[model samples]
Target: MITIPREIKEFIELQGIFAVGTTGVNNIPNISPRIFFRVDENVIYWLDFFKHKSYKNIQANPWVTISVFNKDDLKGFQFRGIVNFITDEPTKLEIKESIIKKTLEKNSSEKIKKLSEKIEVQVIRFEPKVCYSLNPDEFSDMCIGSDVDSTQLFQK
Candidate 1:
């Protein structure tokens, strides 16, 4: 198991999108892009629409992995954990309000209403068990000393 550093946690919180990976009951894996945010040190939340493959996969199997990275920096983190679906209307509304307040501060209620209508708005809570950080700088010495391609490290 890998521990998540504070910096990594902060990075994830700041990022807008993360890739979510899930497997079905038959062991078929599925991956999709999602907008997410951190709820706490151990938990991360995603807004899931009932129409996506991710939602179907999660219903079949709760275990999942999520990856988020800096597009320009080639540095990121991966999280593996169990997922739970939250559909309580009150909780969903609260989260939706908070997200709107933070991300769409200037938008009017009519605009917010239209935006909310398009989203099915299910919250997925992930309780992470393992986390890994990929930092190229940390392996700079090895890259310079060895003949192996350092760029390969950032491919994933």
Candidate 2:
């Protein structure tokens, strides 16, 4: 079983970049960096254009894992979930607003537009089924416990 703690939730929401992993039909794996938002306790959302190998892999296989961390603390969460592609107009607008708010704060209009054009902003929603959190100091001894497998936690 997987557990999600408050610390993990807070860490995921505060991070700017997360890595998403997907597997192909033949079981080959791919990973990509994504800018995402937490829609709820178990759901994460990110935009992807029709382009990109990640999107193609998800379309072929909805199983995926997302990982995020705090750079300063090195504490983070690994999320395993099902992927859903969303392209409705209202969802698109919501995504646009989110992108504008999150990106425009530190970017110029030209840069924003260029990025917006490059991305059609299809939302990739992840509904987490399992989660693993790392706290290097206090939990260092627990790293090798029989019940916990760090390698499997991050694997797709």
lDDT of 2 at 104: 54
TM-scores of all candidate predictions against the true structure = 0.70, 0.72
Tens-digit lDDT track for model 2 on 9-32? 566656767888998777788988
- Best by TM-score, which number? 2
Look at candidate 2 and give me any clashing residue pairs.
Answer: none
> Can you write out model 1's per-residue Cα lDDT over 1-156, one digit (the tens) per residue?
234556666787677678999988777888897653445555777666555677888889887888888978888777667898777888877776566555454445675446556656777778776555656556423321212243453244
Clashes found in each candidate (C-alpha, N, C closer than 3 A): 0, 0
What are the candidates' C-alpha RMSDs?
7.8, 4.8
RMSD of 2: 4.8
